[model samples]
Target: MSNGEMEERIIDHLRRNGKDTALKICKALAVSRSVANKHLYDLEKSKRVKKNDGTPPIWDLMETPDDPRPVLKTDTVEKVSEIVRTGGKTGLKAHEIARDHGLTRKTVNKHLHSLMDKGEVLKTDSNQWTSTGHQDSQASGDVTVSDSVLSKCFDIIGKLGKGAYGCVYKAQHKYDGKMYAVKKVKLTGDADAEVKALAKLEHTNIVRYITCWPSSQDWESCQDTSDQSDSSIVFKGSYTETSDYDSPGMESLSISTESESPAKPSQKHRKESVDPSNPSTTYLFIQMEFCERGTLTTWIRNEKKEQRTIIEIDQIFHEIVSGVEYIHSQNLIHRDLKPDNILFGAEGKVKIGDFGLAATLTNPNGAAIYRTKGRGTRSYMSPEQELHSNYGAKTDIFPLGLIWFEMLWELSTVSEKAYLWPDLRIQKCPEGFCVKYPTEHKFIIMMLSPTPHVRPCATTIKENLDRFFSMNHMLCQKTI
Candidate 1:
């Protein structure tokens, strides 16, 4: 059936059956649960139906008018403005306001844009709506810049990037007057892991961590507890140039599995718990050395355009291996290693940064360490890490393998890279390319080995690279 017909069926069933659960609607209509849940959320967003706060939320038709595009009431618009006002610097999305106020998202948006035209509200770069008169009280009592802390010690130049976890900004220190990257992230239970890792790590190849301080601020979060295809409960909310290094769009998101039992509170209760008007979040401000040259991902994009030489690529890869070797020496595993996490410092030095997923080895003296299911960007994650098995330093090698392939091969466009990532993961090489660089191909294949024990340590890899560079230099001299 068409979407409109499916939705109409859902509404009619709810109207006739009175209050019902999503599962019951699915069974009654002979539709799949995902389809049922999606349509239910759609109805909720449109203000046609509402769900009670219970595990496996019970659905019910709202008392809204039959007209799909009814004009929003004056009081409802006032509530929207108040929600934005209380949101302050942490603005709210129009759909969030619509769900809270029992109005259609389109209706709420219409009024929000109207409010924007009247200078009563403003739309942020993030596309969130906020009141024009609202000002951050800086509840942390420290100097504030663009709604985040650390203006007292550093001059906020501009925002470098933002992620789902927090934001990174470019700042200049008051005393040193040197520019640095400051990452502002929400403080969660294990938030200290990243700070601790960065503090302990000191190397030429790694990003330098200056200092950090804790601060509190009212931050906005959007929670989606919708049922997903994976049968896991997802809580989506909006970490660090400290690119939103987590993803292409610069948004950082964490997906954790939750039980699918009714013992959990209903979605209605969860929604009610969130006060749309006054949401606050605690944060950590991390100060680190600023690399004016940007990330390796950026470097690759530029290289793709200008076509940098293999020798240059080799030098860069050598520096990256140097950084990874140092990280292993410190008994820390950088679970997330990719082009984005590798940054370029002044003079084009390679700096390994973003220790967000880095973990300390339980047995520092041992070669391998076991960790819980490793969580990092998908394409770079090792097979063992992705499988939630007992992985060690070799896990880091897996991503390094992918990075090596990306650095050396000329994939022209992003679409090409995306198309080849899967094949590359299995150690497949481009046509004739492997024959040209037989030794490099063999080394890459070793790193991409499925078995953790089969892969070499970062130290061993670095030694090989050093030897390769030495031989290559001799060969160049011979050619001359």
Candidate 2:
């Protein structure tokens, strides 16, 4: 084909698939990568397409014209009909149908109107078109197990746990048969942040992200709705506050010491007034690698019970720091850092899981930036974060300090944690433990410094641990 024809085909492909990398485009079009790149750059220069700075540059049409030209083909009508039918109850917007087939909005509307005349589809008040079928109606009763989006793709094993906003389900992929953790939460302004953060990260210490999709809230009833007991969900570890503690400089800090149990689901759905025209709230289902060993809280309890050595505890803490280092290297801050958010993966490797409050450092150099305060869990949150202050990567460091303390000491009871949590913040360690691991305690104090600037970065913390372990190993060898 001519150069002009090749560019046109590239534009058409982008319109149909939204975006693609040069390599994929070349393979799809049966053209050489060099040939595709040459034309793609030309179209980019002409402002007909745009390229994203990913590993393999992603190319997509910059924008379509106000009056798009109709895509000509012998079976255009059949294609449009198929897209509508597949859209099901959720339906498709004029633009969605148009872009899906590489056709113009006007062309898709013409086909939609024709289908309406034939009673093949109907447009809802929401301005979305859906097929005229009983199963595809808004008033259709509880979604059947076969028709539910969750059940269609996954074999629902059971509930994993509940979060502040939604519930996590343990499921097995119908095709792959591999287990996965799926989080289902109502769609909100910040609903996609976790997915975006997880998508950008891939590390041994970080949870593996699979994929995500949007589904109507109807999937709830299709799940294990019959079971309303607490046993239905995974039991999460608990935390208690250090009440009645007053320090000279720490009086201004508002640290919550109340018990924080995991959020639970309602036993039954509340019956409420229904607006037939109103649409159901959409929920986002994010699939991730399931960690059977559970959270760091469970791991810590087990280790304490087993009476593990300080050396073994250092290994776990090192792994956690390594994950934080990797996250910081990626220019991301996992604002909500705590034992509950950390998990043990398949081979019992530590993995950071929740990214609900993660923020990307817009600064290319990964410097501290101003952010809204009062985001993370109050107990594990840093003082700088508790105050209305400019924060950055250091916000994450404060929680790491608290986590390290949790690992080293055995505050197994609520009363013990309540009495010790405040003192630990002031770097007042118990007599024996402090003398034994003086270096570790000093580093922990630095990490928990009130001033964000005083706190060491994750990289520095990792290096300190590396040096300490190296020196300790050398001393042991000399004695032997």
Candidate 3:
């Protein structure tokens, strides 16, 4: 086929598939891999497509000749203005801006970087840029969080993390004299579902909801009325039935109930409590215990600490499984469990956070509910999850295996040196280097088994690890 014909076919493939890897296009179009890639590059250069920089490049079509080119000049200026206006506080990455504005990622990145070079935008972090040099008033204008809003809380601290929903901040409660991690989620469709799912959970190993606060600001600063209706729907559910409020949002008050305290209310009563009815505003303030040690990912990546030993691994894994088992018992599936969501508390207690994608396995009538989104990190997701097939508790097991492997190996499986046990066994080993532990290795293998049904249940996994630890103790005694 001619180069033009090959390019057309490649574009068509990306359009049909939404996203297609070069290998897939090559195989489907009967073209060489290199030829397919060259065509993809040309298509991307022509601004007719884009590629997702994952493990493999997944090409996506941008626009066809007949399609109207989206007007991004207005969005670009508005986003920059928001950044400049927010005193560099509310900046979003190019990709995020692109997704929000329905524009091409390439176009967004190009304009954003240009703005950065011109001193109109400042790079806040990798891929995150904000506006600088302007005073708080010049940047925010009337859109600023009112002093009344600020006074209601003790002090708003720095950001903890960002997600699809909203940014989480570490804040101090002056009246209570307590530190709380406050998750400020923008009211959106799925956000309400997340709040409902979280309300059902009362595990010590999970993060507590202090409260939820809703905002009346436009979803994005674009002032585009078309998307405003969609935004209101997303934020409305969290504030229904509150008669005292006269705003569009509400704050949910949450406190960590994990501590053994007679001062705290019982979990049963807390679950049944409801806010007063209101129409103008609905907000929730979720009060959760602050995890000082940060996320498990941060802990693992920080080179300052000594490598985690086998015992530490056992302890951490036990905590994780116990928490997961509790979540399972509550009939909820944490669809997005990962190292980033696992956190360590003041006393080194491990707890699972970020339940935005969690789902209740059973409905109000106790019938099973199946989730369709298949939400999770790709590398840690089970094959069933990756394929968007039916999943259950077994889905969590896959990430458990990957986490264990990383803890033991001190490297990700995606690394070149991370090989299967069988392959490693065939090679000669130096002295003092121990072979992969039979029980632990077997456990990982079982968890990573291709079939979800064959994967060990959470209880079975916990029991197996307990037995393994017991056996290790016996072996140590013999050596002594």
Candidate 4:
């Protein structure tokens, strides 16, 4: 958003793309051609970018300096002068003029600088140039940041995702050769709060945080020697790679229910921090455990494609409840719990993540919790939550119940033959579950109870699940 950020982006883009035209840069970053061109020109003035001699003109990193033999054409100088005139009295920076006329910043700067030396174009104190002799200036608070810090630390493999805030990149630890998800979060203040939040959380059902540190350098200076390309950079050889790397839907987590079992967060991997002298740097990087299975959202869809029985999905639900239980025990409320935040880890285990909206129970030592308005996905919202009343642990009960019901219906056909379970949430139980499986149906209804006071806590849900598994051992043996 700032001038430095724009230029740093150009540097990173050129690193991945090799040699590209200005048009390609504009499209990829969604910046105006003028903005891109202006930034490119500023970078050119700093001797960081270069332009090709070809017809349409290709832009790339300045691997080497340009050779001036013919001394640059006179008409080119006049063209840059014309661009400066368009900006009125304020004139423009070298990059700004280059942007207006679709010229290389390096070429434009050369001519403009020469004109200033010869008393043709006037240079101002703010580094802006004007042909009209009047100075136009505006104060700027924008700071430039580098995209190459991950390159300095890890072997950046490729792009994971990009949004309004920043980007997520796939990377591998240079020392361990293990894969990681490098998420770039914008720092509103120092990166301490997020680090502390991640430190307080540790459990098998929770997404483990590796280490978080602030990068003082912007993207340009941090380039990894291994990341040399003009497109999404990839490190070759033995590093793990997957075809699903480009998808933003990272994990559906069901696939993580593999044989190896998800790794629990060890003491050694907790709370590692790196503090640069200047914490005012714009970006904060959080390195997290990478799950190749993708998100639970993808996992549900995979079931439909594989046509797998819903029986196994029942186990996944139990794992999810286990995660919820851990959070509750820690005196924390996972205000937002749905399939998307429910990630599948290595070895097919479920891990709850994205604690962005989580809140404390106020009293860590007792069963009493502070009541607050609801905070979670609407489809799975509890009755108490929908009313915006003061609620606690029971709030999570409703959504997890709805999700379990949906999974029972859509994620598996095995649930259909379970006798009492319906394809949808119906008021009446035709299979006489209210009488025959009275305990199971009772537990579910307690979760969806209209009053938070009557709803069962997550610990109770886990205990009830244990009962369900014990009552029907045969279902466990019949794998899809």
RMSD per prediction, one decimal?
Answer: 18.2, 16.3, 16.1, 19.7
Best by TM-score: 2
Best of the two (1, 2) by TM-score: 2
In model 1, what are the clashing residue pairs, if there are any?
53-266, 53-268, 53-269, 54-266, 164-252, 165-239, 166-239
Q: What are the per-residue Cα lDDT tens digits for candidate 2 across 147-196?
A: 34565777665565554456677666878878788877644434556778
Q: Model 1: per-residue lDDT, tens digit, 1-480?
A: 678668866765664356788887897778999999999999899787898889978998775666554568865676666778887678887657766766765567657755653346776645578775522333343433344346455655445555666667566687887878777765532346788988999899998999887655422212234422333322221232122234212222111224544122222322112123434334667788887666777666657734766678889999899989998888788888877677778888988887877777655466433343536777778887775435678889998988888877777865797788888888887887698778889899999998889999998998988899888878877887
From the highest lDDT down, the ranking of the candidates is 2, 1, 4, 3
In lDDT terms, how accurate is model 3?
Answer: 0.56
Show where candidate 1 strays beyond 4 Å. Answer: 1-149, 218-280, 363-374
The candidate with the higher TM-score, 2 or 4, is: 2
The reply for model 2, stretches above 4 Å from the true place, is 1-147, 221-233, 239-279, 363-369, 474-480
lDDT of 4 by residue, 1-480 (tens): 678757756765565345788887897778899998888888778778778789768887773345432333765676666667666787677666555556555566668755553335666645677873311110112432234446656765555444334455556787888978776655432133334555678888787888765454433223334433333332111111112111122211122222343323223322222235444435567787776665666666556634644347658888889888888777677666666667767787788865544656655466443233333444455655544434577777766765665554443443443444332233343444457446556666666666777777788788878878655666656642
Instruction: Arrange candidates, best TM-score first.
Output: 2, 1, 3, 4
Q: Mind sharing the TM-score for model 1?
A: 0.58
Compare candidates 3 and 4 on lDDT and give the better one. 4
Query: What lDDT would each prediction earn against the true structure?
Result: 0.68, 0.68, 0.56, 0.57
